[model samples]
Target chain A: METVKFDLEKHTLREVNQYLHSDASVLDGKAVTIDNPNGSHNIAVGLKADVNVTIQGHAGYYAAGMNQLANVVIEGSAGTGVAENMMSGRVHVKGFASNAAGATANGGLLIIDGDAGLRCGISMKGANIVVGGSVGSFSAFMAQAGNLVILGDAGEALGDSLYEARIFVRGNIQSLGSDCEVKPMDDTAKQILVDLLAESGHGDVDPDSFTLLGSARKLYNFHVDNAGDY
Target chain B: MGTKDQLALVRDPFACKPAIIAEHDDYVAIASEFRSLAHLPDIKNAKVFEPAPKEMYVWKL
Candidate 1:
C-alpha cells in the first residue's frame, strides 16, 4: 500500500527513471504516480517489477515500453509506441493513443479507452489488445500472433500480411490487407471475445456484433501462385 | 531554409542504421530497426551493438 510520487516538471527524465529503477524492487506491489508527464518520451520504460504506475498527463513515445509484471495507467493521451514490446502485465490508456500502440508486444493486455492511431498491434506476438474506440489504418499489420479487439470502426487495410493473429472489429473496416480476410466467429471465438471484453471492462458490448478477421494463409510459404497477393 | 552545403555539413555522418535481431525459440526470428524485439518468447540470450556513442552489450536472461 505504498505510494510514490514523481513530478516530471521539476525533475529530469533520467533522474526520475533512475529513482524508479533503483526503487523498483523495493517498491514492488506499490503504487507510483508520475505527475505532469506533458508528453515526455521514454517515460517509465523498461520496468520489470510487479507494481502499478499512473501517469497523470499525456505521455510521449515509448511509455511503458518493454514492461513486465507491472500495471501502467496513462490518465491522458499517449504518443507513439506505448507499451511497445511489453512482455507481460497490463497497460491502460484512459485517452487516445498515437501510432504503433502495443507494437510487437509478446504478452500482456493493452486496453485503450479512446481511439488509437495507425499500426496498432503491428507485429504483435501474443498480447491481447482491446480498443474502446476506433483505430487508424494498417492496424495489426504483419502481426504474427495475438488478438486485437476493436470496439469501434477500423481504418483501411486492417491486418495486412497477418499470420495467426485474431482481429475482432465491431464497426466497419475500410478494407482488408493483403492475404487478410474476414472469418466467421465460431463459438470459441465468441467466448474469447466475451473474455476480452470483460477483461477490458467493456462487458456490455455484444460479442455477436463483431466480425472476425485473420490471415488467409495465402502468403504462408510465399509461392509464385500467390505472388499477386503478396 | 539553409543551403545544400550547410545542410550536408550539419547532417549527422555517424548515423549508422540501427537494427535488432530477435531470435525466438519456436518462431521465425525478426530483424527490424523500427520494431522492438524485447518481448520475444524464450529468449536465451541477446547482444546489442551501437555505433553511435560506441557501445556493445550482451544480456543473458
Candidate 2:
C-alpha cells in the first residue's frame, strides 16, 4: 500500500486536509501517517474515501470528524468529539479520550483502548463504540441507534433517554438515566457483543461479563404519567 | 421526537463554564469550558461569550 506522512510541525492542518481533499481518488488505497501532531484539532476531518490514517501523538478535538470509509488509528489520546458526526469508518484510540468521543456519529466503529470521558456516545446514530476502560457520566445520552460496549465501570446517568441503542457494560453502573433499564442478555445480544469486541480487536474480552442496558420503550410518548421522569 | 433528542441538537449544554482565548503572534487559541473552536480554521480573533451562566473569563496571550 502507498504510504504518506505529514509532519504537523512543518505542515499546517489546512495544508494536510487540503492535500487529502485534492487527492481524494489517489489516497483511497493509501496509508497516511501524521507525526508531531502536538494536540492539533481537526486533523483528519471530512475524509470521504477509504484510507488508513495513523496519528502518532495526541489529538486535540474532533480528530476524525465526519469521517467516511477510512481506518484511523490514534497512537495516543484524543480530545473531545473524537469521531463526531462520523458517517462510516473506523477509529481506534490507543489512549484515553475526552468528552463526546463519538457524538452524533451516524455509522462506524470506534474502539477506545483506554478510559473515555463524559458523553462517550452522546446522540450516537448507528455507530458501534467499544471502550476498553471506564467511561464518565452522561454516556449514551439521547443515543438513537448503536451499540456501546464498556469493559469497565460506567458513571451516573448511563444511557439516559436512550433509544434503540444497546449498551453492554461489565462493571458497576452508578445509575441509569431516565427510560433506560437493565435487560437480560439474550443469545443474539451476546453474539453481537462478542463479534463487536472481536472486530474492535478485543477478542479476549468475555461477552458474558457484560450487563445489557436498553430503552424501556415506555416513555416514547409524552404521557402525563411519565411527566416527572421526563 | 423526545426531549433528549431535541436537547442534543441544541447548543452545547455545558457552555456556562469559564473560557480561555489566547491570542499569540502567529495564531489564536480559544478554549471554552465545554466546547472547542479548534475545528474552525478561519477565525482570527473576536469577542467570545459563554452563552449562558453569565460568568466571563478571558486571557490575552
Candidate 3:
C-alpha cells in the first residue's frame, strides 16, 4: 500500500502509468488528489490493480479508457469517451459528462452525476451506465447488451437500434427508438435500479418514478415496417 | 437588466449584423474561432455544480 500525491507540476500521464505498472502498487488505498487536471486525455489507462484513483479536476477524452480492475473516480466533468471500451471496474463522474461516456464498454459500472451529451453508452456490450441527470438525443443507439438507467428526461429517439440491452428512465422520453417499448417495472427491475442508485450514493430517489426501455425483439433481426424507425 | 435579458443580448449576434454587414464573413470566421474556443482545455479548475435533483435524468441498463 503506497501513497502518492500528484501535483500539477509533477503529474504526467506517463509518470502515473509507470507508477501504476510498477510493483510498488502506486495507489493502493491512498487518495491520489490531482489538482488542476486540465482535461488531460487518457489520464489512467490499462490499470489492473485493486486500487482507487481519484482525479479532483476535469478530464478530457477517454480519461479512463480500457480499465480492467481499478476503481477510478473523477471529481469533475469528463470530456467525450470518458470510459471507452472499458472491460471491468467502476468509473464515476461527479459532474456533467460529454458525448460517448461509455462507448463499446464490455463490462463495469459507469455513474455520471450530471447531464450527459449525445450517444451515451453506444454499442455497449455489458456495461451498466447510471446517469443521475438527463441525456441528449440518440442515447443508447445501436446498443448490443447492457443496462442504461436515466433518472431524468431523455431527448428524442432514445435507443434507436437496440439489442438485448435494457434502459430504464424515470422521466419523460421525447421519443422511443426503433422497436423500443415501455414495459411495466418488475420486481427485478425495481430492485436493480434501487440498488444501483443506492450504491451510486443516490439512494434518496424514488424508484417508482422510473420507466424501463428495452428492445422489442421484433426489429432485432431487421424488418421492413421498422425501416423508418431506424 | 435581468439575467435572462443579459443572456439574450449576449447570444444575439444577429442584432449587430447590419452594422457589421461588411464583416459578415468575418463574423462567421469569428464564430468559428469562438467555437474552437469551446474545445480548449479549461486552464482553471472547472466548476462543479451539484447534481440537480428535479432536472436529473437516469437510464438503467
Candidate 4:
C-alpha cells in the first residue's frame, strides 16, 4: 500500500491526470493523494481502476466526472457538476456542492455531506445519490432512472419533469414539479433507501422517516386528455 | 458588465443561477462557474466562495 502523492502546486493538472490515467497495472489498487487542488476542474476523472484518491482541497467543475471503479473523496466544497456523468465508483464530497452535482451519472454512488445546488442528478440514467443536507431548486429534473436520497429539505421544483427515478426526502419539500408526485413507500423502496443511507454513513437513521417521490407516469406519452398539462 | 467606479455581481432570490466569487491580491474575479476562473494565475491562494442569493457583490478600486 504505497501512497502516491502529487502536489498540484508543483505538477500541472494534466501531468497528475496522466499519471492517474496510466496503465492499469500502475493504477489498480493504488492510493493517491492530491494536495492543494485549489478548486481545479476535472480532478481524478475517468478513472478505471480500483484505486482510492483523496483531493485535499476544494474542487472545481466536474471533479471525478465519468469515473469508474475508483473512490474519490473531496475534502472541501465542490464547484459545479461534481461527479457528473459517472459510470461507476464513489465520489464523496465532504462539503457542499454547487449546481448540477451528479448530473447524468449512469452508475456508482455520490455522497454529499452538505447541501447540493440546483439541478442535482439531472437526467441521470442510473446512479445513487445521497445528500445529507438540502438541495436547491429543480433537482433530479428529468432523471430517467436512479435514486436520489435527500436527508434535509428540498427547494422548489424538487423533481421537475421526472421520469422513472425515485426521490426520497426526509425533510420538507418546497414543491413538487410537473409529473412528480409522492408515491407509496413500500417495503422494497424503504429497503433500497436503507441501503443508500447506510452506504452514505447514515445507517443509524430510521428508513421509515423518508418519503418516496416518483413520476406520476402522466407525461411519458402525449395524450390529448392531458394536453394542457403538457 | 462594468463601467468605471465599481463592479457588482447579483444573484436572484430564486437562485436558479449559480455564481462563484474569488478575491485575490491582484483582482476580484467572479464567474457563473468556477471553471471559468480555474486558469487564472495564483488561483490556488485566492479566496473562493459562493455568492449569497439576493446579495450584491460590489468591488471598489
Candidate 5:
C-alpha cells in the first residue's frame, strides 16, 4: 500500500488538505499520515477521495467535516463537531470528542471510542454513530434520521424533540426529553444493534442489554384542547 | 475546595467551554486545548480525557 506522510509542524494545513483534494485517481487507496496535528482545526475537512487519513495527535474543531468516501482516524481526542455533515465514509476517534460531535451528518459512520460531549448527533439527517462511552446532555436532539448507539450512560434530556431517529443505550439514561419514549426491542432492532456492534469491533456486547428509545409522535400536531386562549 | 498540596479540576454544568485532562506517571496536567500541552514530555503516552460537567476531581499530591 502506498503511503503519504506530512508533518503539520513543518507544513501548513492548507498544503496537506490541498494534496488531499487532488484528483481521486492520485489519492485513491492511499494511506496518508499526518504527524504533530497538535489540536489543529480542520485537519482533514472536505476530503472527497477514498484515501485513509490518520491524525497522529489531537484534532480541533470540524476535523473531518463534509467528508466523503474517505476514512479518517484521529489518534487523540477531537474538538467540537468532528465528522460533522459527512456524506459518506467512516471516521474513528480513538479518544473523546467534544460537543456536537457528528452533528447533521448525511451518510456515514462515526465511531467514538471514548465519551462524547453534548449533542452527539444533533439534527442528524442520515448516518450512524457508535459511542463506546457516555454522552453529555441533549444528545441526538431534533434528529430526523439515522441511528445513535451509546454504550455508556447518557446525560439529561436525551433525544429531545426527536424525529424518526432511533437511539440505543447500553447504560443508564438520566432523563428523557419531550416526546421521546422507550420502545420495545424487536428482532430488527436487535439485528441492527448486533450489526453495529460488529462493525464497530464491539461484537462482544450483548445485544439484549440495550434499550431502544424513539419519538413518541406526540409533538407532530397542534392540540386545540390545551389552547388557553385563541 | 482543596489545599495547595492537591490538584483539583472542575467543569461547568452547561459544558460550553473546552477542557482536556492528561495524566502521566510523573504528573497530571489540564488544559483548554491540546496544542498547549503538545510540547509536554511523553504526551503521547498520557491518558487524555475530558472532565464531565459539574464534576469536581481532586488528585492528591
Candidate 6:
C-alpha cells in the first residue's frame, strides 16, 4: 500500500484534496496519511476510493464532505458539516465535533469520540452517527432515516421534527421535541446499540442507561390542531 | 369547599384559561430572527421535505 503524508504547515486545502483525489489513482489500495492538518476547510471533498485517510490533527469545516467509499479518520476536533452529504464509507473523529457533523448524509457512518454540537445529523438519511460523548440540542432534527447513538447526555429537544430515525441516548435529555417520545428500550434496540457501539470502538460503555427517541408519528403530516405543538 | 367539590372544580371541562397564541407567534418570530442572524437560510423556501432530498448548499463562515 502506498502512503501520502500531508504536512499542513506547508500545504493548502486545494493541494490536499487534489492530492487525495489523484492519489486514489496511483495508490489504489493504499492507506493515506495527512500528517499535522490544522483546521483546513474542505480537506477531502468528493473523494471516491477504497483507501483509508488519517488526518493527524484538527480539521475545519466540511473536512470530508460528500465522501464516497473512503474511510477518513481525523485525530482531533472537527468543525461544522464534517461529513455533509456523504454517500458511503466512514468518517471518524477521535475528538470533539462541531455542528451538523453528518448533515443530510444519505449513507455512511460517523463516529465522534467527543462531544458534538447542535444538529449533528440533521435531516440525515441512512447515516449512522455514534457519539461517545454528549450531543447538543436539536440532534437528529428532521432526520428521515438512520440511527443516532449518543453515549452521553442529550440536550434539550432531542429528535425534534424527526422522521423514522432512531436515537439512543445513554444520559439525560432535557426535553423531547414535538411528537418525539421516549419508548421503552426493547431487546432489538438494545442489541443494536450494543453492536453499533462495539463497531464504533465504544463497546465497553454500558447500554442499559440509554433511552430511545423517535417520532410519535402523530404529527408526521402537519395539521391544524398540531400547529400548537410546533 | 369540600374535597369532592375541589376535585370537581379541578376537573371542570368548561374551565377556560386564556390561550396565549401570541406567545407562540412571538416565539416563531424570535426563532426566525435568530436563524436569520445566524445566516441560516430559510429551509422552508428550499423545500427540504420534498420526496427526493434536495442537496443543501452551505458555505464556510
Predicted structure with the largest lDDT when compared to the true one? 5
> Per-residue CA lDDT of candidate 4, range A64-117, in tens?
999999999998889889999999999999988998999999999999998898
Off by over 4 Å in 6: A23-25, B1-61
lDDT of 3 at B11: 21
**lDDT tens per residue, model 2, A1-230:** 98999998799889888876656678888999998776688989998989999988767789998999989999877877899998999999988787889999899999999888778999999999999998877899999998999999998899999999999999999899999999999988899899999998889887888999999988899899999887
Candidate 1, position B6, lDDT: 27
| lDDT, residue A45, model 6 | 78
lDDT, candidate 1, residue A221? 97
Per-residue lDDT tens digits of candidate 3, residues A23-74? 5354556545565565677777776676678887777678888887778899
Give the per-residue lDDT of model 5 (tens digit) for A1-230.
89999999899999999999999999999999999998889989999999999998899889999999999999888999999998999999998999999999998999999999999999988899999999999999999999999999999889988999989999999998877899999888888889999999899999889999999987767667524311
Measured on C-alpha atoms, candidate 6 has an lDDT of: 0.73
lDDT of 1 at B44: 31
DockQ of each: 0.02, 0.04, 0.06, 0.32, 0.59, 0.02
TM-score value, chain A, candidate 3:
0.92
As for DockQ, the candidate ahead, 2 or 4, is 4
Q: Write the per-residue lDDT of candidate 1 for residues A92-153, one digit (tens) a residue.
A: 99887777899999999999998887789999999999999988778999999889999999
Which has the greatest TM-score? 5
How far is B8's C-alpha from truth in model 5 (Å)? 2.8
Displacement of the residue A219 alpha carbon in candidate 6, Å: 1.5
Instruction: List A-chain TM-scores for all predictions.
Output: 0.97, 0.98, 0.92, 0.97, 0.97, 0.94
True contacts kept of 1: 0.00
Model 4 residue B56 lDDT? 82
Candidate 2 clashing pairs, residues 3+ apart or interchain: none
What TM-score quantifies how close candidate 3 is to the native fold?
A: 0.78
The C-alpha stretches of model 5 lying farther than 4 A from their native spots are: A224-230, B1-4
What is the per-residue lDDT of model 4 for residues B1-61, given as tens digits with 9 covering 90 to 100? Answer: 4769788888887566778777999889988776677778998788777775677888888
lDDT: worst 10-residue window of model 6 chain A: A19-28
